[model samples]
Target: MTTATPQKIRQLVDKLELEAALAIMATVEHPTAEIDYLHGFSLLQVKRDLPRALELLRRSEKAGFAPFWVKYMQAMCLSNLGRRQEALVALSSALGIDGQHVGALNLARLWSLELLREHLPAETTNILKTLERLIPIQTATAPAAKATGAAVRADTNSDAITTDDALMMALLGNPRLFAAPLVPSSGVSGAGIGGTISAGHAQPARHPGLVAVSERLMGRRLTVLDLACGKGGVVLDFLLRGHRAAGLEGNPTYQQRPEGHWLALADHLHLVDLGAMTTGFGEDRFDLVIAWDLLNKAPAATADRLLRLVSEQLLAPDGLLLAWAPPGADDDGDPDGWIRLVPPTGLCRRRPPVTPAELPVLPGLVPVFHSRPEAIPLVQHPHRPVRVVRGRNGLPALREEHRDDLPRVAVISVPKAGTYLVGHLLKTLGYIDSGAHAGMGGFDDYRDLSPAEAKQGGPHLARHIGLSELTRLLHGGQFLVGHIPCTFANRRDLDGFQKLLLLRDLRDAVVSHMRFMADAGRAAGQDWVDIPHGPDRLLRYLQSTGRIYMQMVAGVRPWLDVPDMLTVRFETLMGDQGERQAAATIRALSTHIGLQKPPAWNRIRHQVLGQPTKTWSGQRSRRDGLWTAEVENAFAALGGVELNVAMGYSA
Candidate 1:
């Protein structure tokens, strides 16, 4: 086959007649080994036919072709086919056949050593001897589109190439050669693989932070050249981040796409040949060039050559290079001597990103941002909102919080309305071991104190007893029953700690509050009601028909964060005290706070368990059916659409 000159290849590419160029090459026999390999490489660039390129190389290998170059190309194909393990195998074979093949050596180092650090740790130290040989390519100086192409031309000189036919055929024919060499066998760790007859040493140790950074950068836009992109994790990171990225691997098996349903997902990826990457891509084509873990695996000169290739062809002008490898030793034994190869600077200094409030600081590399957890405030009842915060990490803190608040009782009274009915029931049921409050300053309703009396006492007691103190008391094993609004967000100082929220349906709640205020004669204050005369009118008119449904919804929001809470509807509790049902829920709360069920089960049962849904309608001459229909339609527009009719509310 007549070997196509670089100018000829350029001309064919310009003309968009790549196939014709390949046909011409087929006609020329025993073209220089370089020509044969370049011919296969050229076909790969223009047509992007990995299979065809593999076949061409296979044929070349059979005809006493360059085995090292052929095997390298085979690795690229295998990597593309999603056969990373196979690709690594081919690269190793190529290196074994011709240790002096710098491109293949670097490619192997980058893939097995750098990119796949998560899988291989021994490759870190392998690149140390090769450090000084790395010459920076003039990629930054070249114009964007021309940079990569220029490097390829420089590296593709036929006279500079070497070949090994035995290595090439082995790579081309064997699928197993494409797999990674680092995979652990049976019971052995990945590092325990016995070395080939000559090359044996301890496996490399991969750095965790580098692996994490690479994972994070995956799917993000990275103008990267894997130099040895092994299994495509680096490129995959860019792709996942919705960036246009590609890779170059020398193993032909690495370049070939695998056969699987997943092939459909890789339709847009471009896996170019290692030689062609230098030969094909324009200068400064990539924004960032990465050569992971390659330093320790290859010879010094080859390592230097690969770095030069990266500098000249891959790196973009303002691009950053993320070089991942093991720590290097300096005068002392500190792990700080990690190195990077740039222009005159040689190695860039590493710095960690600053941390912000409520967030952890990023280490090693400069960070953009960090995140942590937070707590938001919530409104449980009309009066108090709930704010949950993390308290002590153990039960001991809970015990301290509850030690002093035990036997804490909330005194509730009703005037004319039925609020006292609930208080009376609680007293009757032994939930609260106290009588109703004794004062009445104003108002007309249940046995509750007047508005004037409640104001003076409520705030004073709240300040003195403080929620924090109460929480502590509860945590220490005390029984607390109260007539409070369930609003706790207002008391910022009080931590919920080991607490259990108790709630009942809005219908019963409004009815109870109305009566409690009426009996107290406004001692609790008109502030408790949303509107003037609301408590009594609501009690008389809509108590049983869901008239206060909106208030019910508003009340539950605060307790959302309380880890230990038990909710009961008044009507449901009116049924039976099912030991299994109520006990199970109580047990869960007890377990959460590290407590056993209280011995006073029956006494606490009536207060904490269910209650009957109390319905109310005064003596009236109106027929039950008429009242039902009217109440149903009337409350439907308000809050009691269905139950109003069932009770007796008329339209």
Candidate 2:
């Protein structure tokens, strides 16, 4: 075999003669690390054997052929392979090692821009392009340079773009565009390349801020009201998550369009000018009120008003606002001084730039909190009628003032003994977590509404929010779930409130709790030593689980003793749901809530049963004995068997 130096082989490869370069490579008997690097580049060039190419790159690095270009090539190949996250890692690593490697920095900059551009709609993209061109290109007018914008890249004397990363914003003249996410959302696949940008599934992945919102509330489905929701994608995402979400689009074109999201969301989308808004739903209603698109372009004063409206009337006390500021808002931000956040992690931000900007607007995913976010009321115009589109698959759409006549109901589960079963069950009885009918998710916790009240009044005191006190807050169709115990002082606290108490086999609860800890252990670092497990780790888990859940289990009797408390068993709810005990439980709920009769189960049973959530266990207790003798002993030691007896489980 012929011996060819890397320089000789590289000459051919540089000429785009990859086949000849590969033929020369095959002739080498014992290749140097440089030759191996060249060989790997040849493979990547020909779009053949990407894995082997990566292996060769690794070998090159390990065999004293380490160079910054090695990582640059690897990042390129990884990005081409659709492993963008891995590509980012390699690029970041390269930057960490060689900060001035222009290739790696350029690639990262380009990738960030692509991610930002891909998420925005064509209209938005066009607007950005127009703004970008606002600042003229100060390149040469030479014939060759005039043919292309290469003069800027070729020019060494030009200092228009600095190293600090103000490149895009400098050329584009808007910090808002650079405010987009530099990376994809860490844990949200709510939308895709062709879905929602700000709110719906009709665009791309959301703006980084919205993606953060989705990731923050990843699995917990809460009521979402997307203001100025475009194409209803975000609303649709919340709806699919089983939250009763609605969207207010002042423009009717989203409905006028032939997009598929309109079908399921036709009943939920409303045409309105929020300047003069009014609905029967009371204050502190929604878990999230997204003003991403609405407040994004609004002036500072207008944005403040809108933020105030959301904080006061729309947002749940425990809820969050996924906010964004207009680029110009930086000019006169907080003009009216009404912007506030309970906590400000929810502020939107652009991802940090690997390249330092000349004039950095936002470098990392650091949020741009221009003014002190405090709370303000935003009033806007026009109430619109409900318009259900024609193509739904027989899904009912309601126009009543958001179920205001429905009773204020409270659901309390004794730890993991019960799942979110009764909450969904009560939905079958005209309860509204979001809309008029039973939805996929709900029983909005009343505590979330009165956080200050709950904190000041203590646990049981919130449920004591007597009937007259709750009349306006409940607004008829409210359903809340909490962990309030039936105490001596507050046993009568729930007198006017329709109460539900969920119970389970203490043995099964212990087993589930143990399984949860073990599962958690797999991902946890050494810091999760809170659970003390011994040589027989399984047995220790069982004992530990029983001890941990014992307090909640011990408090179950007071709920059972309260005759007004509608006690529902987890086993009965999950097992033969049609069995006598289950039927009796259902009857008790209906009678306790003052419903005329039980609902037709088969018709709405699927909706009531509810789907598995993030916390749902594949090994969730099905029958009995999900625990052991050790666990039973631990429960007995904690005096928790009373709940098992009251729930009618054989001890």
Candidate 3:
């Protein structure tokens, strides 16, 4: 084979007269120039001629050269050019065509904050969540510019930690936008992200005035209530002081504590809802009501209701109300005027009394002694008010910071009687060190999460796990248990790649679900029909129930097999062996995860079973005549037929 010489090639090119040949070759229309220009634009991008490249890409696109990567790169060029809004539009268009394009996802997550700063100022949460979704399915290798709103990429294991921290900081630091900060209740000194934040050396209060006030309040079996107990800081203070403590907070994450028998701890601490209490439980229930500095949180109406509730329900017979106003609250002439506690009688005496905010504003409320202990200092000094509530002003500024070097254990569960009981037992039995449940996730839900799914949804509730608590556990080695919905969103936490696919007798499950839902009032607008027994509302029932099941099963597959899962029949769960097996299983799980069972678990279980003829459902139980039939049909209709057969279903 002979190679053509340059002179011969030139002679051939001259003979062809390529440009003139092309002009003569196609008198008809053709997209040759547009295609050539697109090729050129790609080369320019490779050569770093971003502006010219982008312009060419725009021209190509205008000429109908449709390609996914081209648009995606154009967006990248726009972003590099600081045209964030334009970049977002280009990326959005690219994503609309291909939702999971990594380049677009990276761009979205990397520039989310910057894009947000440029566009919708109010939808910050939406933007952050969007970025949270785009976090590489792969682990990060190194920390990137979190402060500058750039995507942080670190090693996979470390990335989990870094991503979690950045999310927490963003939410907490920017409270104006991210209204809900991910905060956990308490821990065995380790469990979730908040625990990690508490891991550092304790900072003694530099404010001598604040220290004195804290110490003075340590007097007596003080019944203390911490309002809006984020990360349980004040609650921990009460525990340290050996005082009777309780906390009131609206955030669901706080109730999802990592400590074993967490609620038992609450009972021990004397925490109760003063507004929602049984009659004859106790009169003049509390000794002190402390509504710390949480005034400027939300709707003013809601704030006033909280304030008034504290004044009435939480105050003791001769109790004192401790309130703190930020420095900004004192802008009006009277320093004491910032906080005015008026008695019910005093309020009534006023000519047309002013309406109090919050709820159940008592008419007889009256203001008591008002004092300003100028000596107190805050954690972070602002020109703001020193928020501290105590009876004394003389004490040490700092106390020793205590760190608990415990293993990490998470127990997942949806809201159910046995779920909480199991969580209690795990802690008490010394099987698990720490656990949390918002009663949101379903039981046995975490047994099927894949690495990909875990990364996607983990941070949504990552704060529930104390980063400090997990300090000792290996990355990916730390344990988590949850009852989150087995839906597409939470399947990330499932074990392996698939669920164990547990099957219970459909009739029995329906009965149990009915009883459970009635007790919980979880599903909205579910009322019984008027009949001797009852008309079956099985459709709505199965819709919600099956929806959750399908979501879970769909999310976990190929990576995990059904054998790795466990499906306890509802009847079995309540049977004689049920409690024993459940208890034993919890014990086994704790041992597997490295944790101690809480001592209170057994006691709680015993108390639960000891009650005779357990009328647990009471008036809520609506007998359903067709429940069994409807459930049977539903099981056959859904993917449960095979499962039912696998579980040895005959009918």
Candidate 4:
């Protein structure tokens, strides 16, 4: 009746010892859902025993183990057995559980297209159409010959020209489009169009002007179209508020399931060609057209055509177009209104500019509101504009400052070294309330600023009052956080700034970072999954061109010898043994920051040490000798041992 852990079974499976794995599973008197799933998966994939795998999978499902992966595996088994209908059904069920399951969606699109084409609801027909365009079926003679022929025909039909036609035409027109290209869309996932930057990257708190605009348009009887909608967060927001909203993405890889059944069935989401100068939507079709981050992708010729199309064809006579210029759009000095485009080859080309002033004279459209909103101060484009004809200009400034008597403190740490923990601790101690600004290491503001601008007071210091104004702004309570390397180049900016540098064991830090990158890459459908995981890969990463591990060590090395910098080890504030040390560190930090009254160390300890925030990739064992001998040898070879010892770790 003894049971083996899933990890042990997984290890056996990893080693290709399928028989041993099965034997271990057989020992479990009452095999749990997980055990059944692992056994079934191994049998199906490794042993290729389809019937037995199906039986075990069904049992696993019966035993309450019906996750999306289990369902997907079942569908795969059915497909391999030539049970098309059952496979399609299982895949559909998997999609129902999680619509964006990439593998399931890809399989369904490839094998179950006929079923989807015939059975998809009328409102969801566009989904099938989009899939058809992205993944064309191959013929014996040519893989995409049929699609290419259709595209040529579609392009010739100028009256009924679609986004697809425009894309085809562009590709056909420019023989060298892909050759020596600048700003090429390499390594970018097509899971969604214009997916260059994720919607999550847009911090609403940092850009309240956008939120305000959304709030103002809420409950309006407008038909909205979001061009190049990456992830469709804005469209979803509009839909949630009962507005008619649709998103057009240019990337073929982007796929998402709307939360509501109605939203999913509405066929509001479309996959379109952003590179195309014109979308087939009729003139005066949309009451509101939003092109949040679309312009940068288009070249000069294309941008001009797109603007003309937007002005003359897309917007209703009385409708509004909300557009924001990209980071460096205004710097292009072409008097004829041309802007520079950065292509994939790292070369720049002049393109027709889409400026704010042109909106006023664009046929029927007229500018209503235009301003460089305070929220977007970091934008490099000098003439960055937020223009709306029918919309109001009443959005409150996004930036807010609070002044208090408490001394300002900056908690700096190596990336992935429990920065969040220290920040949360400081927040809990009341050194700074919610009103206090907690930047990502203090360099959050400098991220968009140029190196020269950053050197000259940095973004926050320059944009706001200079260092002299820091006393007024950060009087009673001010805390900053940053991971910027402490080097001679940045010494001027760090001068007069009080800092606490946090460190962790180099070996653990590198492992944590690698796993994090892998997890994040997989979630974003990036190529990080192809990179092998383990000691060899870890060593390769340390020795890679970036030399990230060396940089990390060097970043903290300079600060170690500084008189005023308080150095704290991550291990000291982690786990049961470190609870007392955590309390002491907090006390020391409070004293350093000149807090009026020392915080309740017991309460702070309970909040931070007693219940630490779980690491994003799950907790790793803190036991010594976790690193393999090869990894240790590589670390030594890479000079990590010296850095580790200098950073207070025993060699």
Candidate 5:
């Protein structure tokens, strides 16, 4: 069989002709190791045959194909296979051998930032910074439309190319490779992977602020009305998320769909003068009313009337009023004045748009204020948005002026502890989401550590948060989250950050651990974690796993004593006494961090607590007392009771 060129296969892949690509793979009979590496890499996009793909990548490595490509793709496979810890370790190793490979770094930047959070390991950070420094592509109009037509290319070079099947295959896989402007000169950048994008491939995202806000509020469906929205920019943001969002633009130009501008959302855009809105215009009260710069533009009295009106009628009790503040003589003649009717409970600030949305009426980045239970004084909410599959770790910071007044906080807790509950309080208190969540940054990642690695524990907070990353996190308005056992290394690493340690009752912790493990195991297709039946097998499982359970019960001890750390018990923030204790905890936390207590605690609590976090599997059996007698007796027999007492929990 004639060894097919990579260009032909890539053309097929680009045109969505999978069978032809597979046929090219079928023709490889006595392939070299490099071809095998290429073959394995291409299979990564295939879903069911991943195990075989992994096997080939390993085989390629053993056959001396290339240490860098083999290990790098292996890390990608591991992550996709739901083995993130192994993937991180594998990536760290591969990066060591890469020696600042530019193409490799560019390919892996999004994944690295996604998995590691903003403060990455020192090695990954260096590579990504290099990628960030690269010049963006010149234009999107690459002349590579049919560039991968290797199959029908003149046969003069066939004899020479036939000798290096791998090289031909590599080029065959790059669709835009033949386009001079599209392909960079550094040939070996994505040698085996076959996928590469210059910085300018896609257009910049429009209305990132709106995108961010959509993602943050994506936890639930809500009706949002953005007043004075030109061309209905906010509609597209919520449109993708299935939220019903519309614009009330008084400008007839926008309402009628101006000649040059898009009227894509003309149906959703209502031609109503917001300045004259004294009574209800929309029949249903909105869950979120985005009065973008409406209040700021009106006179003080008119603004106050609009504020009282939005609060008293237009807004649902739990609705948010995102309004800009009027220029005030109220704050002793300060320009950035507060709203006179009701103070804002929660505030949001976002960086200005780099390329503002089309007909952007302060689209998402207008830096408007967010109000709960009333009209918002003009402030800013960084329209923070993230993709479901793509993580949002390296998002730009809130502008200095907006963030200076907010608080910086860190919470380190055990798995299944009250992570989201505290996160809820922090969000309500005006802390921006730093794109870190306990779902990924927890002991869950630690479970993959080999016994030797686990025993030789070092700084376990995201494995090692760099000093520079920690410094930026110190800026007010954002909070950090991680689940780690207290360690000397962690204590040293978290030295400058304000730390809060959260723990749950050991008995509840142990029970939640079991259920979580079983549920997670099933979700990951690890059927072996399920015990077959009855007491004897369960006893065998316990004998092997009992130590891990005890560790969850007790691992948070040293965390309690970190210098000036505010120790918050998970039970205190949830369960029967949750309302009373949570209020107290928030007050204590605000005082400890020296930030103003965010108002409307009940409303924030209702919105936050009512939503289920990503990690929430079901009604937590903790409140139901699932393993009370049996687990307690066994734990008592194992001396966990003493440890529980030390943590100030009941015996």
Candidate 6:
């Protein structure tokens, strides 16, 4: 029997004539490794048959054909099949064979960071280091050019080219990788990854500001556009409210009809080149335009051009444009005249200050909302500003009437006291949603401000938003959750707000803190604050930090005295009676916040408890006994007993 040439088989595969290619290969008397690999590749890419693809790839591996590529494909198939551990090993084998293989290295870094960060910290670090070295560095003078199709081909062997390089090339061309479904394992601490508030479902407890704004615009026929709408979560929420809404996303991949199950309103999403000024939308097409986190990422010129285009072509006359403006964005060429709805604060020290001429501007747009500097410090971004502007194309500007009667609530807690859990529960119950604000500076206490301090240009507190601004947020139905120390200065800010203070056993909190610090240290590549491993280190650190901890506890003392303030013990929420305790806490919170009707408690309960609990060390259970008598005596000597009693814990 004679065999068809490899070149002929390749041509058939290239044309996507998979059946013909397979038929041709079957006639080959003794098939080569290349034949097996090509058949497998076609099975995986063309037919999307994972099981058959894996089978063929394994056969190709046995035939000793392109071992690295075969292993890599096997790993991808295994991952898709949910065999993550096996996938990791296959990926590792591929990398071992060809250390410089970019695709395999990228996958290794992603998988290790996602699934094995705790189990394989060193390996994760090495993968990151390899990626850093392999990825070209870009400088101001010469930007990193997108790799062309030919360049991608040049980077890989011909057989390997069809598998790994094609995927990487697709990713390079699409640029909408940000819109990829977030892997469940990739979420950082205090971040909400899943369980989005679906359209028309009761509003989520998070992002109350968005809900309040949406409510104000309700009862009107308005066309809304979300610019650069990554994953279109916010746009879906708008659609649920029965509004005529559309999302313009730059990523081509995200522009496709989203999974119908996830979004029934996916038809409204459109893909456009956000980098281009002319988006082809008709003039005055949208009544409201939202551009979140877009301008800050673009070059100054591109940003200015995009804003002008948005104002002139996209936004209706008198339409509102809500944008995020980092500090220094308001300096000189303020073309859009974006008024800071909230005072700006530098969120990170590494951010360079924006000069007047460098500030993004859209000509003819004017700020309708002016910020009052005298209001309470808005600590969230401290450095970044939320700008609201009106496209003044000879139309009457719509004014936002502040609703003063909305219920306001605040959730305050010490660090590492399961505040995230409480916040998640509140979100599930359809209360104020502030998920965006969870990891921001405003959610932190003064101790957490040290990083912001290095970036501060003037008085530390000067960057904070004033009480008036905070009141405005509350009036807009914002839910404030933070670890803000209850200082006298912050008391006035807390006044009249329904408050909830979350407490945990100090010892447990200390243990949690130690684990958190260690994890964070490893992640940041920093030393663990001079503390050694074991109980002695924990005890000594607790002793040294007792005053700060006491201060945190003391901050809540005044709130405890307030009749309306709800106090929740963290242990109860974690105990065997956790569900009952959580339900009761929710009820107390609902009443305090003046909810007209209670949320679906059972549903919220399931959502809250169903979440996978994250633990740092299995030894955490054993460490409870690590507080020896001497440690207890030392802690008491440092005033832990008084603080413990004040917080309702038996010391």
RMSD of each: 33.1, 25.4, 23.6, 25.9, 23.8, 25.6
TM-score of model 3 (CA atoms)? 0.28
Candidate 2 lDDT by residue in tens digits, 1-651 = 444466778787767688898898888888888878888888887888898888777667545365556765677677778765456545655554465544444565556455435544564554344322322232434232010011123222121122222222222223332211111112212212222223423222223234223322321334567776766655644443223466665554555554424432344666555544433144225555665544544554556556666655665533456544334433343422123332232333222211222111221221232211322111111112233322122322221223423355767666665534565566567775422111111111222233233223211221212222222243335565544434321232233356788777766665565555455442133222344543234345434333325444543445675545677777777655555666666777787775776775555667756454323455565325334566456557655675577667776
Ranking by lDDT: 6, 4, 5, 2, 3, 1
| Poorest 10 consecutive residues by lDDT, candidate 4 | 145-154
Q: How do the residues 1-651 of candidate 3 rate in per-residue lDDT, one tens digit apiece?
A: 123332332343345333432333224234343433443343343455568757666555534355455566567677677765456556655554465544345555455444334443463555344334423343333333110112232234321212222222222223122211112132112222222111112221111222124322221234555554443434534443233355444434545543211231333222223223222123223444554444333334444455555444554433444444444333334433324333321211111111123211213332222112211111121112211222122221111111122333343332222343334343444333222222121111222344234223321232222222222121222233433322211222232111222234544444555555444443334333111233355554554455334223222221122223443332343444556775664444444544454333355566444232211333322234655666656655655555444445555
Ranking by TM-score: 6, 4, 5, 2, 3, 1
Number of backbone collisions per candidate: 134, 35, 81, 23, 18, 25
lDDT of 6: 0.49
> How many angstroms is residue 341 displaced in model 6 relative to the true structure, after the best TM-score fit?
48
| Window of ten residues with lowest summed lDDT in model 3 | 345-354
In the range 478-554, model 4's lDDT, one tens digit per residue, is 46555544432133233324578888887788777666655544213323335577555565555441143444455
Of 1 and 4, the candidate ranking higher by lDDT: 4
lDDT of 6 by residue, 188-297 (tens): 12222221211212212123245234323221224567766655555644443333466655554433332211132234555455565354353225545667555555
Candidate 6 regions exceeding 4 Å error are 1-406, 435-463, 487-489, 522-533, 576-579, 610-623
TM per model? Answer: 0.24, 0.32, 0.28, 0.34, 0.34, 0.35
The whole-model lDDT of each prediction reads 0.36, 0.47, 0.36, 0.48, 0.48, 0.49
